[model samples]
Target: MVATAETGVRRAAGTVPRPLRGTGIGWLFVTPFVVVFAVFWAGPLLVGLGMSFTDMRSTDVRNPLGVELVGLRNYLRLFDDELMRRAAVNTLVFVVTTLPLTIGLGLAAAVALNSGIARLPAAFFRLGYYLPYVTSIIGIAVAWRFLLDPEAGPVNQLLAAVGVDGPSWLADETLALPVIIVMTAWRSFGFDMIILLAALQGIPKELYEAAEVDGAGRWARFRWVTVPMLRPALLFCTVYSSIGFTQFMEEPLVMTRGGPAGATTSASLAIYNQFGSGNFGYAGAAATVLFTVIAALAFLQFRLGRSR
Candidate 1:
């Protein structure tokens, strides 16, 4: 018994358990990702955070360490900047307009697909809807530019046939932001559709059948059964869509260039402009503020989702 115990003790001391051995291998495989993430994401975030508190500028590029720390001065400047206020309002408007439209269209598409549509037709619809998302933003923007061209585009041509002159959609300050919102919604709805579709598929048909058997009409079943079952998915889509809409830069940058008196200047586009103008520290502060807003909004969304 002593020999057996000693042998077991020696084995335990020399070799890891099976579970621990597997865990060690898993961590080894994950180490490369950890290193890369730390180097690329975490490192830059720390550097940028530090930069936000300084008076760094284009001239400081050659002597970064020589830049003076300005503490909260950069952040204070953000509040008094009329352009920043405009950008904030634009971003808010964009988020409010696009979030509902995108999620609504996506939910509608997902429900249509989850219904009794034939497999082949549904597959085709899925492909058509999702195609825009996988396509390059540059290509999408170019296509939108062509389609919305005031004199030469098909939309205006159709309007002209009805004896109505279509205005320059992207160049008019009043119309530019709305047009961008529509474009963004069209490009984004497909992603939400895919997510909602997966969730819809996972829902058991039994619950739906029971609702029907209880004499619930289509709308009733949808309101009670479908909507309740889809809450989690809807929450996820809402939060994800909110964050994306808040940071939307490419659409405005490419489509309208935040033009026509900056009607379409989103927060991110404003930050990009600051960076381009070599106000690195100011840009950094703006970026940090934007990041905080995003994080707070996300947290609020998650809290609401949990409550629901």
Candidate 2:
């Protein structure tokens, strides 16, 4: 009976499956990424955090072991720093103005292109809009500087043709920041437009047809159907543009250098100026504060997105 049972079991188990491999192999594949992240990203972050609590300066490079911990002194100084205050206000203004404009223009462009009004290939229009985003920032800044030149720029020249004198865009403190905001918005809207376009494409045509059959007009359908469907994309673009605007540096640095009485200075530019002046501790403190603000904003955006 035992022998018969054993033979029956062998017959039932014909072509036995191999045992599944363990997760050890998967860990091995991910080990390199983990190692690199720890060494580069995690390590630097920890060091920077430590540096923020101390009076670490560029001169300390000669005596790396002799740094003194001042315990919040750097952070306290930030409150009294007039330049930092100006930078913070400038950054806030940039965020308030640029975020809406970027998202609005992007959505408008996406809608127009998706509507097929240009009578050109969609790819051509898409590429044309996206070109500035891919181009180098320095190159764009240089071109814009020329275009915004009060005396020789084509923009001012065009204004002259119409007998409207263009302001000294980069020279006047009052207009400089606004000009930078506009330039930044133009360069950034392309990315948001592309993302929104993809989201728009993913929406089913039946939804629009259903709305039309239900007596929904163009604006009504857009408000009821389109906006709701595009909420996730819009949320992403808003949060992304918000963060970028808050941390604005390169444009102001290259274009204005925080000039015209530092009207265009941003938090990043302030940090850069501090770092350049060998006030490493102060810079790190400012950086940590900026990081906190960005993190808080991101958290709020996430909560809002989830709530909606």
Candidate 3:
């Protein structure tokens, strides 16, 4: 009787009760992305993982079932390979060197852009800085090669005019990796600048005003107010740059071909070289190791960020 009375009251109030349905509408909106992810990402990852355990070659493509499962032998081989160790070292060097320069330069540029710049000029500078990020990396590498050419290139020409003879930049193992690092840092920092710039604009002006009123100098204000507030953005940039740099391949592949005595061969480039040389199982093993390292580093970064 009470329930009937409530239903009558609800009707009188122009409210109607409906049966609870499943989340069909929500799934309707999400199904496309789920399908795409399954087909592209999940499927390939499983295939690659399985391939790493088998002694599969490109020649076995016609009879994939005949390829022998080698267990962990392919992975074990990586430890004994001298070139693989060299590539691992080179990758580590690239990530460590490029990450700091990219982040520091980007943060500086973002602060410059956000501080007292007029709207029109700020927009112009923002676009200019961001162009390299959107530009094709291959094209950037090619242009960098031309500019750093020891002969006839404008950079070397200027050096010659100043009575300094330019050495073969890309041909020297000592110089090739450094040259690649500079190119990569210059090309990538603009992306970080844009991210940090957005974060800067979101910061409240009242915070700065308060710091100034407290007699905080510019450095004190930045170190205290700005750095603390930008922690999340900084964390994101660090993880993203770490992941991207771990897979560093294009710069070395295009600019130096990992040449001058394998000095610039990153782990990704090594994987590509192995695959090209028909060692598909070995390449798969290398790729799996690289993926594991990337995952571990990213997790560590997140853990450190969370602890702080």
Give the top-scoring candidate (TM-score): 1
lDDT of each: 0.91, 0.90, 0.90
TM-score of every candidate: 0.91, 0.90, 0.90
Steric clash pairs (candidate 2): none
Query: What's model 3's TM-score?
Result: 0.90
1-308 per-residue lDDT for model 3 (tens digits): 22335679888668644437666866888999999999998887877888899999999889999899999999999999999999999999999999999999899999999889899999998888888888997888878889888886789999999999988899998999999998888888999999899889889999999999999999999999999988878888999999999999999999989988999999999999999998888888899899999999988888788788
Best by lDDT: 1
What is the lDDT for 82 in model 2? 96
Lowest lDDT sum, 10 consecutive residues, model 1, at 1-10
What are the RMSDs of all candidates, in order?
8.1, 10.0, 8.5
| Number of clashing residue pairs, candidate 3 | 0
The runs of at least 3 residues in candidate 2 whose Cα sits more than 4 Å from the true structure, single-residue gaps closed, are 1-20, 116-120
Candidate 3 has its poorest 10 consecutive residues by lDDT at 1-10
Please give the distance, in angstroms, between residue 149's alpha carbon in candidate 3 and its true position after superposition: 1.5
lDDT of 1 by residue, 119-140 (tens): 9999999999988889888899
